[model samples]
Target: MTTWRPDVLGDGYEQLELPLGTDPDGEGEISATLVRYQPPSTDLPDRAVLYVHGFTDYFFQQHLAEHFAARGYRFFALDLRKCGRSRAPGHTPHFVTDLSHYDAELDEALRVVREEVGGGVLLAAHSTGGLVLPLWLDRLRRRPGGVAAAGIVGLVLNSPWFDLQGPSYLRNVGTAAVDIVGRLRPRALIPLPKTEAYGRSLQCDGWRYDLDWKPLTGFPVRFGWLRAVRRGQAVLHRGLDIGVPSLILRSGASRFAPRYDASVDTVDAVLDVRQIARWAGCLGNRTTIVPIDGARHDVFLSTPGPLAEAFRELDLWLEWLDGADEADTSGSRTEADDSDDSDDSATVSVLHRLTGEHA
Candidate 1:
């Protein structure tokens, strides 16, 4: 049996520990943390939203949960093993040799969510979590009654790290080197230039996120982890049918700034937006890709203007999804939503004002 208790966010939130026994990466016992949002007056919806955070992140976005709750969704977020509230003493910070290891916690989390909601689930993820969930969904689609049996109805990816950003040589040559070195020293940290630009922008811009969990420069990238991410990307590039429609949100521009500047607040300082748009089609199924103008890597975290636009886009997509679900129940094909392809163009124009032709 699992138990829920008060969360660090205080009031109306609770967390549960999902023990997964010993770690396969040789880091001793390991477990994931599941946090729930239950504010008074908010009735639990039949469907729930399961949100997964990206690398170097956890479930700290309380406003995000409330937003879902307002739309009648019971919100649940996971802090994967060794991340945020799940990190135990002596355990490495977000270190995993294979992304598949996360399957255990994801399965457990879904089980709990279904047990409580008894309806369908809407998947939501940010950055790396965006990558991890689709991969897991692809695999899950082949098991037993398929993804629908697991109660997953749709997916929403926020700036998913699709292809490894940087020069082409890094994806080709550097990947091979990382794989070799990763096998030799799995925990070896990859040397990267440190910068507090993005983190500082968030802090000074009114976001009071904990720096200890999500550091200014982020946790050191390990060779083993890089190798795992590369493998995941390779698989994603081959294409995957997640067996559900997906909504992908990303920034319209990407700017790599070594230090803090004005651009850090509006553009994606992490993954390339073009890369996100380029391979987004590979996700298969009916996919809608929307670029939020002047948005950060995490569109929801962007400063006032872009952040609101991001929410607007999300609301529109969810409304469309709800309509599609109703159509499916009324003997109409859910693909009917595709008849309005013009909607995609209109949404893009809303963001393309600043830059043109991302994907």
Candidate 2:
């Protein structure tokens, strides 16, 4: 991998530009940015993480990197083509007619991580990224033995978008309309109910990210993009056997409001938590679903009380994975932990009470 120069994150982070050929959207000469976090010490032993951001998002979570780096894992994040740092001039920001097209960058990024980081990498993603990685992992399991397939030993999802939010009939009918419109006019904009509640809670007067990229209300929803997301969600609903141990964290409650309220401070003001809890089981066996009491749409970006809880839960899950990996190596792993599964033998655990020292 060629590390030409410094990335947007600067300092310890550097960017590797992957030439992905032509963009199907006709944006021309496509490339994706792989932001690598250089560990302070070259002696840090065998562990790494690859973080994928959601729609209209990029890997800007320094806290997340700190969490993993402190635990001795080299960290990297992908700015998927046409999003964040990878968005070139004349390219439609975060526009993709097919989610499967992302497999190219995702595969390349994983390969680079495995080669550069030199260890089993944990694939962690948030929101729409949560949906994207699971689908990719499911495909990875079916691959004929490759680095991208073998490198990702585990997955940690932050509030995955399993199903569409809003009313049932609307989700059904609206998606149908979106499918038709997307096929006809791929770039057509969907008329959506604008809600700034989640934005107010997250951005809070530019407390965090670059508003131009992330935005206070988020990027506009495109017909083809939503259709692609729905197609992925449908595949998820049909159940995917994503072969590796996974952890999903979400807000236990969701409160959607037109105007800002105190409730938005603690709840998931974006997607429905019930839908996440309902379809999380479809991600195959050996999945742990955690519901943070006061987490926002993104669990890691939650407030102090619940964000700490989310991190603690993540740490606990990481420990469980180490044990599970040891068991697998010793040939003591069970059928539920199989690499390829055709049945709904998933063990979805919800940790309500803090256990052991975690309490």
Candidate 3:
């Protein structure tokens, strides 16, 4: 059983501490945090969404929580071991030798959601998380009593890190380099882009987020970590059958200039959109790909124009999901009075603008 209490992101949210048993990094005992969002007036819902944040990211997107709650989803986001609220002083932030290691926490999080919400779940992931969940889901589908029994109905990926950014040689040869070097010096800091283009796009006053959690430059990338990411990318390039329908969203293009420029606002500064398009089909199940023009790497974080469009696409996908689950769903939503479908855009533009810095 899981005990819930007020979370760090406090307003009507609660946190559950998931014990991850032992740690491979010599950090004493490791654990992860799962944050749940249930509006004050609402009851334990029959519809829920379990979200996973990407590398160097946590669950601070309040508007995203609000968006789902409006559609009658009891939203929850996981802060994986060594990241966000679960980061211990001895732990290297976001460090893992293999992505599969996350299964420990992912399994527990799903169990808790299944027990509390008592209905099917929709997995929503961002960036590296996009890569993590599909692989995890593929494995679950192969299992007889794993998360597959918990009813994960659909998947939504936000600018999934399907492939590495840069020339073909870098993704191929560079990955090999990391593989060897990681064995010798796993914690070595892999050099990152000097330009803070993506940082600039996210740090503006329009989107009030904490710089502490999501730094302007980003956390250091480690050789072992990058190697693990490369391995995941290699697997995705081959192909995967997650066994559930998926929705992938990306910006129209990618901009990799070494220095900051205005293009940062209109294109994905973090990932190559072409890579996303190339690998979107690998997800197997009926996959829907939406490319929003002028969107940022995180479509929901884009400027008003593209931001609104992204939400619209999200609405359409959810509608499709509802139709698919129509046979089993009880079709009950005890939503708050203001939890209307039309609040998507207003939740992005208006509510996010009113968001304050993390205290």
Candidate 4:
């Protein structure tokens, strides 16, 4: 456990907490952090984006926020309970028995974004965050007038964990064994080594980022967390209808051996990229899969060459969504203009009225 300093993010962001009351099992209070990235203007943004970070990671991507801002979208990121900025001294980093536990934080965050920014939010999540959001959205869809079916307009997943990244036997039997161990010793640290090559490939070794936020050596993998992740992966395998346009991005290939070589720079050594492409169709009807050559796990965090390519693809996609001539799949030309008078204003006003007392 390294002592973390609060210099991980840029200057304009505020750390806000949401109380989740006592844990259902009577453990303690559960809370989450909301990191806001307000645009440099008073006029509300026509679009909003909510970013969720991956395991062993936090909302440190200021560059990403700038990208969204440049395109006229207000961006926000969440550091879920027990992860990054939200992690308390006694709590385990990234530990949760059920993925559903994130709903409380996510629901509140969405409400805040919808109220303050007054628009449909595009969800952008990476890795484990990718896994968590879709399932959360699915659950939200079941409830009447839930956040998932309401404010979210689309989803953008970067290397989503659609399934476990090992042999079938290991995914099944090994996961079961790990689950048993997790039940017995939830907090016990287990070995889940991260390769140095991947770290180097991302330029996050030391110079690029503060070590406290994203440790080069990575964080411990607890049994409880692994079990929870395995459970979530199983659900993703069954498929989800998020009921929105989705963009799935991944490296072209995967390399998973001990040797740290230049190949690590080109492919996703952390996860099975093929699996990302295969199950991508399961997301929804308007899903688009784009494979970037020589990209890392978190595509935006890739090296300069691959990173630029990823951004190019992202810009093109956003442009297309904005009703550009090149790729207008939505077939709605006035969508962006129509957003000015969107029904979201009424929703935002109501949410503001409901949450005004808390503010």
Candidate 5:
């Protein structure tokens, strides 16, 4: 049986530990944590949302949970093994040789959410988690009943890391070098220049959370982790059909800065937004991509103006998803109808209003 206790987020939030028996990375025993928001109101919606945080991050976005809860969803977040509440003394933070190792915890988290909500789920992820979910969902699609049986209705990705950021050589020669070094010394930290621009943008802008869990300078990037991420991106580039439509949100521009500045709050200081747009179509099945103008790497963490615009776009897509479901129920829509030009044009119109660009 699973047990849940009050989470560090305090009132209305609780966490359940998901034990994975042994650590594949030999970091002793390790586990993941599943957090849920239990609102005071008795009435609940049939739908639920499962959120996964990005690299060097945890589920401390209380307002994000509240937003989903306000929409009547039973919101849940997963801190993957050795991340956030799941990290142990001996464990290297967010270290894993292969991304697929996360499957155990993700599978467990989905099961619990399905058992509690007894309805469809919307998978939400950010950055690295964004990359992880699509790969997982593609694997899930090949199962007996596929995503529908798993209760996954759609996906919402916040600035997904679709490709390795930087110049072409990094993805080519650098990847080969990383694979060799990573296999040789899996826990060796990659010597990356220290920067706190992304973290500073959040704290200096009035958002407050535990710095220890999500430090300003961020955690050291392990060679193994980077190798795993690159491998995942390579697979993603090949193409994947997650079996459900996905809504991808990204910033309009990318500005890589070594130090915090006013501009850090206005653009994606972590990743190249163009890469996100380029690889978005690789996700396959009816994908909708929206670039939130003046937004950060994490669109939800952006400033008020862009933040609201991001949410507005998200709501529009959610409404469209619901309409499609309704149409399916009324027997007026078929799988082939998912490619309707009229609906596609309407989506483009929504994008034009949000970003002032054609889809």
Candidate 6:
């Protein structure tokens, strides 16, 4: 049985625990958590959004869930196996030798969401999570009569790590070396320089988040993990026809050199934003790429101005998805309140703003 508790941030969020269960590999019993938000409603939602966090991160964006909820959508976020709220005493945070191993947990989480919400789901993923989902969906498409392709209506990727960021030679030679090292010492730590620049950009340091959930310092990047990520990236580079509408968001520029400067706040200093923009079209038939100026790697968590613009762009994309305005793909219109009840005023206002409505 899974037990749920309110998140410490007090943002109308809950954390779920999957108690010790038999580890499929006979390693031991495995435990995990599913961070969820069910939008205070008795009736089935019209739609649902499943959010997946990136490497060295967990579900912390409650406002994103509230935004979806006000739009009459149920929202749920998973802290994948061995990550964040799911990390156990013996388990490493965000440590997976192969990305495909996540499919089982993801599939199970989807099943739970489908049972509870009873609507088509939109996948919203960030960074490494963005990389994992598309690859999983592609494999699912190959399966005869797979549920994933049918259940997922759309996709939203935030600064996906599509390719390695360093020089071509490094990626070529380093990846091979990493693979060998992974095979020999999967747990060996390869220290990568850390910077407070990314954290400062989002203003998350002094916030309500628990440092344990998302450390001020990121997790170590091991040879096995990098190799696994590279393998996933290779598959993404090959191309995936997800057959669903997708919205890809990234910073206008990228800076990967090892220097902590103010530019880190305005551009993506972690991954290659240009590569993400270049491959955004490969997602599906109806794909939209929106590059936000002065945005951080995670646009929604950017500074006030850029963050608002990012949300506005997202609202417009949602409007486009609803086919509200064929000519207005930019989602710039204000939303009109169709609901009469004052009790729902706050919810409605949030929904409108999320859908690009001002009022």
Q: What lDDT would each prediction earn against the true structure?
A: 0.86, 0.79, 0.80, 0.72, 0.86, 0.72
Summarize candidate 5's per-residue lDDT along 1-359 as a digit string, tens digits: 97899999999999999999899889999999999999887687889999999998999888889988877689999999999999999888899999999999999999999999899999999999999999999999899998888999889999999888778986798899999999899888889899988989998888887777788898999899999999999999998889887888878778999999899999999888778777887887767777777999989999999999888888777766776753342231112112222343344454444333345
lDDT per residue as tens, model 2, 176-275: 9999999999898887777778778776624477777787677889998999999999999898878777788878778889978777889888888778
On the 0 to 100 scale, the lDDT of residue 312 in model 1 is 83
lDDT of 6 by residue, 79-137 (tens): 88878877777776777788888887887777777776677788899999999988887
Candidate with best lDDT: 1
- Name the Cα RMSD for model 4: 10.8
Instruction: Give the higher-TM-score candidate: 1 or 3.
Output: 1
Error of 1 at 135 (Å): 0.4
Q: Residues 48-144, candidate 4, lDDT per residue (tens digit)? A: 8999988878888888888888788888889888778777666766778788888888988888778767777989999999899988887876789
* TM-score (all chains, Cα) for each model: 0.92, 0.90, 0.88, 0.83, 0.92, 0.84
Count of backbone clashes, every candidate in sequence: 0, 1, 0, 0, 0, 2
Clashing pairs in 2: 285-346
Q: Where does candidate 6 stray beyond 4 Å?
A: 1-3, 19-27, 42-44, 147-150, 204-207, 256-261, 324-359
Q: Which stretches of candidate 1 lie above 4 Å from their native place? A: 325-359
* Model 3 alpha-carbon drift over 4 Å, by segment: 145-147, 325-359
Output the worst ten-in-a-row residue range by lDDT, candidate 6: 334-343
**Model 5 clashing residue pairs (backbone):** none
| lDDT of prediction 3 | 0.80
- Among all windows of 10 consecutive residues in model 2, the one with the lowest summed lDDT is 335-344
lDDT of 6 at 98: 88
